[model samples]
Target: MPVAFRLPLQVFYEREARHPRQPFLVQPIGGGAVQTLTWGDVGHQARCAAHWLRARELPQGSHIALISKNCAHWIIADLAIWMAGHVSVPLYPNLTADSVTHVLQHSEAVLVFIGKLDDWPTMAPGVPAGVPTISLPLCPAGDFDYRWADLQGCSPIQDDPLPPASALATIIYTSGTTGLPKGVMHSFGALGFAATHGTELFGLGEGDRLLSYLPLCHVAERMFVEMASIYTGQTVYFAESLDTFLTDLRRARPTALFGVPRIWTKFQMGVYARIPGKRLDRLLRLPFIGKRVGHKVLAGLGLDALRIALSGAAPVPEALLRWYQRLGLDVLEVYGMTENCGYSHVCRPGQQKIGWIGLPCPGVEVRIDQAGEVQVRSGATMLGYFKDAQRTAEVLTEDGFLRTGDKGEQDADGRLRLTGRLKEIFKTSKGKYVAPAPIENRLAEHARIEQVCVVGDGLTAPMGLCVLSTVGQPEARHALQDSLERWLEQVNAALDKHERLRQLVVVKDTWAVENGFLTPTLKIKRNVIESTYGPQFQVWSERTEVILWQD
Candidate 1:
């Protein structure tokens, strides 16, 4: 059967009935207490939760929101909502009350499911009036109301006819780096198709395991972590936290893992932190020492067992991808967005190439528009943005192709190499177009360069604001600056006259979500960086050398 016609909750329940004792999910809550749930338990719990939702006297297809960290119950609530024929909306845990209010008001969600409730007070004001909320780990201390367990005691609902495959199943809000968050509506067919292709493309099966650490709200995690489990009946493990991510990976020994470029980059840094790149490369030049060291580093990262490690959600520096390749992990770069049900293109196992997002996935058609913007027609194209038809028309073409808003080209071998966002291209003072992503990707490819923002708006040539190399020692910082200058010279020589970087600013700190420089998925907010540092670039540009920020 085509996956687009399959209901995931139905299949998951069948797996539970077939193998009640088999582990479906393994999560460590805290203090040596583990939360283990088999498919049977999940099936039973979701049915009861479905029954409770049905009894709520709300209209069918009503919206229910989930706000939480990565946890097992977060997923359970999601499936339960779908079982009840409702739309599930997930919110990032780090969003402020104002932003949360906007989503709640925008979605008109009837109820909320909050997991790992730490700071509920800050989130309380965001809940729209008349909406009831249920907390997963901890119940709301005040009037917010309800606990996850409250619905568990309800009667288990026998399956009624499941919703039609074309019915709206989920509404994922885009992170909105460029504009206000739009509720991206996806049908069961769209999501299921992505899972089907993803499972087959990655060779996922019953034996495979996956660690879920990235925000479940994100389409990448939702597709790779959640839907992969449904398609292949693989065990899905939720990470306790970043500190426990490695331990969880080792414990699960995941065969399939998905991470953003920043995470992969950090893993590369961790490997090199113990063994300097020069010594390691020299050792790798030999036969036995190189093999031994490579195995050790991969094993330490718990990635030695990974068959398919994916990087997506933002452009990854080619250097990081190649570094992992040297260590024997075939890290494939994927290009996708929430609108496409989290998949559009992927690099197959043996066909990886750095600096390219790779070939289109099975069942997806990709073509470059005359303006160089990539367009896609696929089974997974979103139905439309919720209640925003005009906005939907803006992205979806009249001929059924979805405008990707990304400028890219297909290589001779059909691999899609993304250049930058069509909207993000800036015009320099010399009236030349500057594509920052390609430049940023190249500059960030340097071993000593961590994060970079290519800035040249209204300027003669683009200059870079870079997060300094994390591995540099106090004395090495100065020397690293010299090395970066030389690296830039090489990069500049390869660029067109207008594309060359005029100067570089070495930022002392890493751009992090906590610092408001990067989004939760680790994509740099170009507007924020440009606005924050644009004034300083002129002063620093006068000095031709790398301007190191001391404080």
Candidate 2:
């Protein structure tokens, strides 16, 4: 059963009472010793920030924007916002100026917290005039109306009461893959139920360590890293940057680790770079040396202590799941989104499976409608999309079930396997329809391909726009073409006639959030890809060679 949270503020206070001196946050300061903040430290600092908010005299229940990457101060600001009776509006650090502006205007943010960003100059123009901006610690760039120290100068509030369970806690904007982002409003109860339940399910405890590297703006990371730490009184570590991610991970030695499929895939690729996959496969065959090799590999990555390994945000290829399982670390694929408070379903530890998003979580109900839309009615479901009644009505049903636009079916055992998105299916010129997800997952196993987008609209057979992995460089594309063709042929044989990929076009540049090809959550923006490459598809598809190189 989930722990009742009348207000989120109570959770922190309770944790502080239990372990005041325990390190709650371990943050990396560049070129120096890491900074570790205790529970008491966080409590005092957060209280000061809360008092600072009170002095601003903004309207009660005002919206406040938090724009930055993950950090210790981000959590402090979130707690402070709620403590002062204002709802938080977190913005993705990777968001463009247009997106940042839209969220600010849509949420009606009265003030913004700025920290740990590189593109503040570009993002500065988006901020409305006269709206106060407070710069926080670890901010490598930008000047603000108020510094982080200004908040700490105020005396801490002693008797700030916890808000009602029904009070709005946050307005999380979705990382849009196709269009402008939509803000999903969640209550204190909704967020609390998921966090406390997750702590219970994962068996997280005080000694457990967690690495908070993913964007906190995303609900998945927010729940597992921030809320789980608070509810369980666990230690949380922050990554310094991409350069020191390994150092940070090793320092944390997290017992309960969570990542998106992309991060898991990157881990696999990193392993392969150090030790060739073919060689590792050969070694694993030897019963004597195999276990030692796998153990060493995991330990080297600082993941040896990980009791729980989870992946979400995108469909993980079963091959990726088995790759880690061979190392004795099974990746449990979870199913949920921002609308569900990231608590709809989770694969149990020992009963993990490929392709299936395991049983529904406790107090969560999931069912498939006649149209194959996965629907859920859970305590964690968001109240609604903030102020977008029409859009909210489109996704929610009369019976209070949230209509997830994903197409999927439940097995006899109630395991859900998502097929694809309803709107993502495209009809070929041959009058055949194809789902890209399964195909994408299957092809994603190719070691040489970084990302593959299967495009077949108005064509007889689908072709792929692939970005080469670091191993499959542009200069080596010709040498690797034969090997790539062999893999492509094998993938094609396993698919239905219409679903088979005809050709593979290697694009030069990698798809990234900064490049507009991916969302902040690392989801491929299909619309953006189509717009950029749709014009060149016909010319590339007509090539006689099995592989086409854009560069």
Candidate 3:
């Protein structure tokens, strides 16, 4: 099916004209209060901001950077950049000063927008000394050249400016789990195709509501919340902070929600903390009480009204999906990358396969090469990596397919099930190759385990290293050790001789973003983990105990 393509600004203009008074953005200020902006309000602010940008007379298609957590002003700033015929470059709000400096210098962004952030002091030094900056509402204390208030009195740009569909829209940097981040360039037409076809495929429209809590710099959130809202005319709500997430969720009562695997796991753990999982399971098996309990639990989480629940950014464990399924929520797994505008595959509502990432999306084509890497071609494919032609040509083929680097297989029905990353496969001392993701996923089925990494790579056999969840932290060491031993035995029973784990080691330190163990998107950095723990691997593997503790 050929879908109609329209630029994001064009769609926003139409929505603004059709329903000027409709609530378009719901932003949570401080102190348990929210300010709802109508389409008219957002249009006026965006137009005024656009006028401010145009007055500066920056070069055509100048790169303008935006650094902020998800907020109303973030979207307004993006609109202003597009209207002023400039390209946007969004930096993750959680990036370090070094990363911020690298992106700004590489993109050559002439101007920057500073918005809501938690750690401004650490990142403020990265903005080059002379670069101009505009501050958005809720921004941390800084000496910005312009503030949101400064744009209030400017006359709104009367004419609607429509850039060509092929114009560059944004440059989203990769999460850089392995090395330095690469800038992925996406055109307006590419993003428009994803937003348009995705909205139609998901049956989204004006009645839908979404909460924008994920980092807007991520393609998943940009396509799901920012671009989708413009295409579907849906209302977007911003989460205030981690402490008030539940409060913000309840206030929004969004009809659609998107969460990553870690968030879902945390939610499950939260539920277990209050109502023991065993007791909740028993209650959910009962006749009339099961329905009531399910409704109550979902309502408590402020997801009772969610018509669509999506999980992406990382592979979700099958056990986690099943747990949510028992609770009357079907978390559809989605698979895509920054190179494809996050619009490749999705598990359709009725046709969801537990472990599979589902079929290719409406206009996406998927294939598996001889090496088992998943390759995708779509209208939403990126133009290429910005200023790195050699690297771009290596990943994107002459035929337009993007090498996804994920090893996967397709069922007879065409659903894609990812096994592991091609680059992550390692050889043991015996020259036996092992893929850690499948083993880690199997070990993660145990409720006590929070994060698991299987390491062997030149060793005789692989071993599992894990960080305990909050639920597992308080349990007696002996009991927890016995439980892990039994779980390890069960998991090993299903593996091949060479693939069986030699032992399980419980690490003392937690894996987190701040400590350099995880990326901003919460994906584990394998190189960092290996470097930090590699010295202890031989000693731990030589131990006799089935479950060893880091001493």
Identify the leading candidate in terms of lDDT.
3
lDDT of 2 by residue, 1-551 (tens): 65454346788888877788999999898884689999999989989999999998988889999998999999999988988889999999877787788999999999999988877888888888888899989885666899989999999999756878788899999998878889999999998878867777878789999999999999999999988888888899999888999988888888988898889888888888888889988887788788898888899999999998888888998888888888888889898989988888889888876779898887888888898889998889999999899999999999999988899988887888899988889888899999888888888888877788888898877888888777566336557788879988999999988898879888877899888898877889999989999998777777787888786
Model 3, 184: alpha-carbon shift in Å? 0.3
Ranking by lDDT: 3, 2, 1
Cα-based lDDT at residue 128, candidate 2: 85
lDDT of each: 0.82, 0.87, 0.91
Name the best candidate (by TM-score): 3
What does the lDDT read for residue 224 in candidate 3? 95
Which parts of model 1 are misplaced by more than 4 Å? 1-5, 138-143, 473-475, 546-551
lDDT at residue 271 of model 2 (Cα atoms):
86
* Model 2 worst lDDT window (10 residues): 1-10
TM-score of candidate 1 against the unseen true structure: 0.96
> Per-residue lDDT of 1-551 in model 1, one digit per residue for the tens?
23344666656766877888888888787765678898878778878898889899789899999998878788788888988889999998888788899998899898998886556788778887778888775333656477767888898898743677788898999987866789999988888778777778876788889998888898889988888897788998877767777788788888888999888888877777888888877776677777777777888988778888888887888767767766767788888889998788999988877777789988888889889999998889999998899999999999888998899998899999988989889998889998888888888888876788888878877888888656753436667767877888888989998899887777766678866788878888887887778777777766656445535
lDDT of 2 at 31: 88
- At residue 174, candidate 2 shows an lDDT of 93
lDDT of 3 by residue, 347-405 (tens): 99988888899988888988899999999998899999999999999999999999999
Provide the TM-score for each candidate, comma-separated. Answer: 0.96, 0.97, 0.98
